[model samples]
Target chain A: MARWGMVIDLDKCTACGACMAACREENNIPASGPELAGDGRSIFWMDMLTITEGEYPNIKKRMLPRPCFQCENPPCTKVCPVGATYKNEDGLVAQIYARCIGCRYCVNGCPYNAKYFNWYPPRFRDEEKRYLNPDVSVRPKGVVEKCSFCAHRLVRVREKAAAENREIADGDFTTACQDTCPAKAIAFGDLDNPYSEVSRLAHSVRAFTLLEDLGTRPKVFYLTEGEKHGRFKI
Target chain B: MDDSKYNELDEELLLRPILKTGKWFYISCAILFSIAMFAVWVWYHQWSTGLGVTGMNRPVFWGIYITNFVFFIGISHAGTLISAILRLCQAEWRRAITRAAEVITVLVLFFGVFNIIVDLGRPDRALNVLKHGQFRSPLLWDVTSISIYLTASSTYLLLPLIPDIALLRERKTRLRWLYRLLSFGWTGTDKQKHRLEKAISVMAILVIPIAISVHTVVSWVFGMTVQPMWHSTIFGPYFVVGAIYSGMAALLVAMALIRKLYHLERYIKEIHFNNLGKLLLVFTLLWFYFTFTEYLTTFYGSEPTHMTVFYSKLTGHFAPEFWVMVLCCFLIPLAVLVRKKTRTAAGCVVASIAITIGMWLERFTIVVPTLVNPRLPYPRGIYHPTWVEWSITAGCFAFFILLYMAFTKIFPIVSIWEIKEGRESSVSETADRVKTYLPT
Candidate 1:
């Protein structure tokens, strides 16, 4: 089984939101509406948070693209009363949409605010629904949803790999965010494979997980910009 | 044993059925219950819609729903702890008060559990908690412990009432059907009396710890969390003390009301209220001491997270509520209860009302303040329950009162058998004691 992971290189990345847009479209997430901002109804699977540090005129902006960390010891998974959410055999914390009781215990228990509750029955344009990937299940109201790392794409990769009589490749199961990154800043692959790009990037000196002190052991890593980008802000 | 004594007992038994048929009894019940039913209809709207009906939002995920949960649960501790502890301590005045307190426990426990469903985004999914419950979670512990306590409390309430049921069965022929069905063949034989005594003894002994665990577990639901204000070690004992404090106040309210409404002045006298008021005063001081220590340590530590919540309660948004709660729960009650003049029935009722309100504010302070001030740099949370939340909360209170009303109709609110036994046993004993102590 693959130990799925991602490494985002801050130095190589521009502050473009192409990855965010791609992730939303690929996952059929709702576009940001005025009423939904900070309401837990906005369905941004890939969120861009801008952190500014330093005094007025010397301000710096660092864009952090956050997805669910898919922690090895996921607090959200641990607190889910219904076994609706759990860590799979491959270490990915998966959500069983049908099984979720909509307790929101997982949402309250998650420190990162990675999970989002479906406050309303999902609303989408007719044309947009037509474009949605048939493989992913649309969530109902009250259930929580989050970035699944395009796990449906991985299932497709597995099927294709089986049919072709070959093992899955690193690029074969790339998430929508990684596939559409203009700067090639995001690397997604098996971290256990020594030769995989994700493993190589993950072991970089600047690679770190957010709130590492929390002991969540997040599979997602962020690579800070070098001395030239000045300082890591916020 | 004599004709005059029999006439008095007969008069005592007649009072319950008469009250059940009082002029506005059913009319008032209908009006109050229809309002409760309307509230239930509103709850259905909440069930269909999402939790958006409630004013809960990001960061302040819990509001009045959770606060009411804690508050109702706090009031429930009044029953088993006070009654059982007093019984064990051999406080004879407890005979009249125990049933009142125990009934509150069962009703409040039911109300408290319902409040959780009201808080849920999906009330239908409540079974999922039991089906896939995590034993390690404090919530699951709460489910387990509270259920056990409820069962024990209900049994304790019923066991002592068996003899009374038998009395109604034998003495009152008109109410023979109910007495016959409910009395469980309670023949006042020596062996039966022995078994009843043994059962009551077992329950009184066992219930005290279970009662204590219920509130301790409740406190742990918040204390186990890493939230700034909630994660205190003192929470367990602090909650237990608060429970007992408020429980005594509830007892006073019930006692005074029952005394007036049922004319149970002989059973529940001024001495009973005086004893209860004294206990309430002790808890008032203890609760104040705990609050002082709890806040003083946090203030001295000056940790940003703890101090934020502490100052917020002391002099911020919650300051008015906090100070008012202190005055109502402790200062005024303490002043009134200590003075001989103010320790009367009306005075205790006022003090009890004050304590009840103060305890509710305490629950709100505990639940909301910590939630509003999370440790992170994200926006601080604020909560104000929407109409849906308010209606359901009102429905819960109405349901509690309705249950108590139903209980009074079914059983003698004054514990007729206990009063008989007290009258029989005490008169002889008091004369002997008085004679023994004279001119000593």
Candidate 2:
């Protein structure tokens, strides 16, 4: 079984927010409108974590595009009483939207704060509904939704690969955020495959996972923003 | 105030509210019932409109509902644990007060469990917890323990009540049918009384552990999580202490109210409060120790994640609530309950009211500040409970009082047989028991 993972190179990222927009469209995440957004009810499958450093005019800012880390030892899934969120065989942490009791236990359990609860039913104008990705389900209000590593794309690609009598290859499935990165910052592939880009990127000296000491063992890695040093610089 | 009334201290005063309905009782019932109805409507509004009616959002996934859940559950501990302990110790003074305390446990538990359901984003699908039960989750542990506690506590509340219900059956009241049905054919034969007393004694022994487990499990709901300040070793015992502290205060307030409303001064005397007040003093000290240890450990350890939440409560946005909680749960209660001059039944009630409010704030502080200050650099979440939360909270308190009032209307709030039994035999039993324990 393949463990789907991601690596985002901070040095290459421009933080233009294309990934956020593309993710909303790909995942059918509803536009929560300004009022709800201001109330902290806004849902973002691929959100930007803006890191501001230094002070005054000398300030440095870097936006890190964040998706669910899909931890090997996911604390979120462990606390879900209903087993609504779980790590599937392919090693992607996925949600069973229908089964979610919306206790929000997993939301509180996750150290990274990756999960988002739907505060309202997904709403769109009659014309806007057509723009929603047919492959994605519109999550109901009260249930949590998060990054699925574009699992639907994986399913479609798997079917295609089977029909062609071949293995599901690298680059066959890519997350919306990874596909939309103009600077080629985000990498998505089978982390177990040593030949895959994500696998090599993840082994880089600058590679780090958010809150590694938490023991969540996140599959998502980040290449540090500044100068690349030490071993495996490329 | 009558000399004749003092001459005869019997079940007549205890049964007065049941037999003769007071005007204020009906008035309070109507008011409480209307508020409860309004709260139901508000909850429905939240249900139909989604949980968004409350001020809860992304980071602050829980708010007043969780606070109320913990608060009510903590209050519930006041009843069963105290009554059980008193019964186990054979405290003669517990006779008039145990029923009042037990009723609080049985009644408060419903609200405590219901707050969790109401807080659910999908209350309709709550059965998912049972269907696809994950034992690993602390929430499931809570579900299991609390249900066991509810069953055990309700049984505990009812077991001692059999003799009282049987006595109520003797009176030719309108609801004599319920009394008869509930009394379980207790003809008060020596054999029946012996069995009933044995059953109550066994349950009294059993309930203390169950009661402790319930609060500890409740604490684990937060403590098990990896949240900064929450993931602490002291939480289980700390929460149990707080539960008992709050429970003690709640029981005092309840007893004081019943004493005034039901003209139960002859039974629920100042001395009962005095004994409970002494216990309350010990708990007040214990609560302070736990609070100090918890915060100090967090403060001194200086774990950045823990510090953020600690500072938030200590001097940030939650400073007012934190200090007030300290005042109510610690300082005021300590000041009022410590002195011999001020530690009256009236003083106990005043301190209890403060402790109840303080404990609720304590729950709020424990739940919110951690979520608001997450480990990540996410913007800090500020919680402001909306009208929906406030209304439901007020309604629950009002309804709890209303239930207590209703409890008095149907049955004697004071156990008839136990106190009568106390009157007949406690003196001799104590003398005999004392001699057994006395060294030659």
Candidate 3:
């Protein structure tokens, strides 16, 4: 059995927001125009958060990249009246858009605010429509969507591995964010395999999960910058 | 009392709305119906466009629709629960008020259910909650409990109306068939009365828990979340108290309005308002107690995210609304009802109106502030309800009034037989009971 996980090294992250862009492009997330975005209607499955600490010249800035933590005990799944969102056996938090009634209960339940609602019909330029990913279904208005860890890639990888009659390779499947990360900050793989890079990185001393005390047991891990680095004092 | 005089009073008071069609009634109905139709058109626009027509956004996904849902549901608590409790206690004053209260419960609950549908992004898929519902979710609990409460409340409302329906049927009014179908040949025999009394008693006992559970479950829709201010052990009882508080205020307002408009002052007397005002005062204190405890614990514990929401409500963006709520729900009611001089019928009316507004604000405060300041360090999301949302809200109120108006025309707003029963039997029965209690 595979337990997919991710490890994002905050020290390596540049806050370039490419991961957000890549996730949106890969997942077919809607584009809310500037007017709607100003109202906080923008959809970003992977988001970049910057925290500023201290005043004046003593200030330091820290950047945090956030995606769905895919908690082992997902609060969002627990409150979904229609069972539209659920944690799969392979440890992926999956959202069935067709089943979603768009009550927005799951959107509110998510502690990390990873979920996004399609407030309007997804907008695509005439040229951009041709570039829409065929593998991924374009979600209609009135459903929730979030980062799926590029779960479709996993499906393709699994099919290839099965046809080749061999075990799935760690390097074979990577999330779009992981693939597009300029600094190679995000690592994705089966956490159950100790030999996997994600498992090794997750075991590092500085490795932590966002809101760890929430007891969501998020599959996503973060290796924080060491104390000698410009980690914010606060 | 002379039977002829009593009969004349009944004929004039109870039958007036049915027998007579005044110009004011037609005008009010036309106005209310027009506003309600306009709201329906707005909803149609939303259905054609999307939820984006409203002010809801990423983090603050729930807006005024949810606020109205909670508010109307809380208003529903004013009906069957209060009426049932009063009936169980054999309070004589309840005879003039229970029908109005129960009607409010039924009509308001319909609006409450509609608000949920209006809030849904895909209202067409709403039945999926039943078709593929997961029982584990608090939302499912809400669906289950609310449906049960609605059924129980409607049945409870109908049970007492049988005798009245029979009365209307006998009179051969305009809607005679409707009354006959509803009356079920209720002949007012001893057996029939005994059955009706038994049913009302059983329902009175059954309805309290269902009514309590309905609001408690509604609270859980927020409380069960890990959101800062919403996750509280006190939410169940707190919401129940709030519901009853708001419900009492709604009932008083309705009673006062009916009294003035229908010339029901002789029946819905000053004493009813005074007693209901005192009850409102008790709930006001209770609501304040819960609010104090809820906020005090959050303030003292000072969990970073929780404190953000707490401070936001206390001294930040939500402060004005929060303070206004306190003033309307607590200060005004406390000042008015605590003093004998100001606890007049008019005074109670003022307090009731204040509490109704206060309770609506309370629901808004509870829902929005927490979402605006999420656990994550996102910028505070601003929620300004769009005109569409406002129109829908206005429409809901207009619809409720229209339904209530139609109901008053069809049936006696006060339970005629119950009042007659009370007048004829209770005086002698109370004397016997008082004698039995003396030196026993």
Candidate 4:
């Protein structure tokens, strides 16, 4: 009955892409190199956006790590033709690979650009294959894949918690990105728990959600640095 | 009752003598069917290899498959709406065009539904739509509405044709067995006439809303999304207007083609083209208005997510296609249709093709541009169709043409019974009305 959420502190973040790489590896995402990137072939689950403010010399650049917001009222799930993608009870958007008709309506419906389609069959080098997360199933060609909030890991964490005869603790579950942040600016916990770190941090004046006008009611919150005006560009 | 009047009636009733067996007809059909089979082969390849074969990618996931679906469905709307509207208005000229238009609607509906399956990654599992469909999804709405529209349209298209079939059955003694089966025991009695009138009336009334719902549901597939370009309230009426616009153009094209092929220039005169062109012009303006209103609101708001997609369509990667759609769909067609000399059958033919192609490009522009411009921007997504996608798309067109051609051969493409009824019912009724209205 716990609702998972994340608060990313923009102040400590220095735009390092280590979180991106770690998340990709942890999720078993296939890397799409140069040839396919602009041609609609690239597949990146968590994409980082750079938004710059002010004129040159006084320019301030901000890096925003973007993943699926996992909206409570997800537009992506509403348009899927075959029930391939759906929002679970815990508010995590999930894809049912076997049922997908690959109509790509969900991909088109998602405003976040969070979803990635497998253009060609996934190409993994020998080392990359060895590094693949055994817990997550590798996606085949045509079907879409995106950030599942490390759903597979959550399952393992839940099983462990159950074995201990207790519910999941505040720190028991975390996304690959939240666990890998070098700056420790990211916090993940149950939003349903008032005592949880995510719930406490989400109420900060520095905390705000993206595209609030869209009415998506995203579970992910971003806490700005609050040091400079217009510091967070996008 | 007089001999002279009866002979005049007979001549009017038989516009053109029905041509029964022909070797060339059979040969052409076989060739077309074979081509359709080849297209099916390409579709099978797509089924196995996945969408990777097509030019479509993540952002451009729709491409030709969705475009063709919209195109074919738009074309199908022509017959039902035109016939119903004209019949309700009591337009006498509708008689000649109704049967031909109805046939187009039925054939194109079949093609439209087939194209969706062709676009599916797992078309074999299409049955799951009924088995496990979610009511909240717009896609499920589309499935339900399209089926309902198709059923209502087919019935509407065929009900008027039955009397025509019966007429053909009465004349063709050699093929009595075949006619007897298709005639559905129509006796052409006063009671039968009353029953047929009632059926046509009910179908005509029901078909209009169903037709509107079909396109509205299709738009919901895009509008229900939170994607910047697609998430507009205007999408419902906007899509319906586009459907009718393209549908009208398609009807005009079919009329021209049928007139030429069947040498029915006398029946399908310049007036029909002129009237249809005028209707097309109205739609062209309406389409422009909708596009302007939809874009102006998005532009004025200047929402970054909306602007990214708007700019992408207006001056970015999709600029060429976007402008081309505007030109072909509205500007050029309008120019050609406005002038009397260019509003001829040939001119209308060119315009119809333009409108059809333009509408398809519109779908592509709408689907792909928004996808490339994500809410949280990454590197812009790119889409290139693989050969399999191209092959499958081509095959779908071939399949449609094949179905239409086959349909023409199996039944009289020009509904025999309807034409006879038209010929039988038209002149006398007009003369009676004229007689009643004349001052003594």
Best by TM-score: 3
> TM-score: which is higher, 1 or 2?
2
Positional deviation of A91 in candidate 2, in angstroms? 1.2
Candidate order (lDDT): 3, 2, 1, 4
Off by over 4 Å in 2: A225-234, B1-9
Per-residue lDDT of candidate 2, residues B1-440 (tens digit): 44322223576777788889978778879999999999999999999999988999989999999999999999999999999999898888998899999999999999998899999888999999999999999999999999999999989989888887988888788888898999999888999988998999999998999999999989998998899888988999999999999999999988998899787887899999999999999999999999999999888899888888899999999999999999999999999999978899989999999998999999999999999987877788978999999999988988888888888888788887777777777888899999999899
Residue B52, candidate 4: how far off, in angstroms? 1.7
TM-score of 4: 0.89
TM-score of each: 0.90, 0.97, 0.98, 0.89
Docking class of 3: medium
| Residue A196 miss distance in model 1 (angstroms) | 2.7
Put down candidate 1 lDDT per residue, A39-125, tens digits, no spaces.
Answer: 534666788767766789999777888889999888778666667788888789899887777766666666666777776677788
**Least accurate 10 contiguous residues by lDDT in model 3 chain A:** A225-234
Residue range with the least summed lDDT across 10 consecutive positions in model 1 chain B: B3-12
**Candidate 4, which segments miss by more than 4 Å at Cα?**
A32-38, A52-61, A121-134, A227-234, B1-35, B168-179, B384-387, B431-440
Worst-scoring 10-residue span by lDDT in model 2 chain B: B1-10
State the DockQ of every prediction: 0.37, 0.61, 0.77, 0.55
Q: Write the per-residue lDDT of candidate 1 for residues B88-204, one digit (tens) a residue.
A: 776668878888888999889988888887777666777877887777667778888989998999899889888877777766446679878888999889999899889998999
lDDT of each: 0.80, 0.89, 0.89, 0.78
Q: Model 3, range A49-147, lDDT digits (tens) per residue?
A: 767777979987778888888899898999999999998877889989898998999999998899999888888878778778888998888889888
Model 2 clash number: 1
Q: lDDT tens string, model 4, B1-440?
A: 54213344442333343444357656866776776777778777776776666777666567767777877787777889888888877677786787777777887887788878877766777787887788888889989999898889888877876776676676644556776787789988999989998999888888899888988888888888777878789998998899888888878887897687656775678998988888888888999999999999999999877888899999998899999999999888999998989998989988999998899888888877776666663556676656665666666666666666555544555554545555667678878888998998
Better of 1 and 3 by TM-score: 3
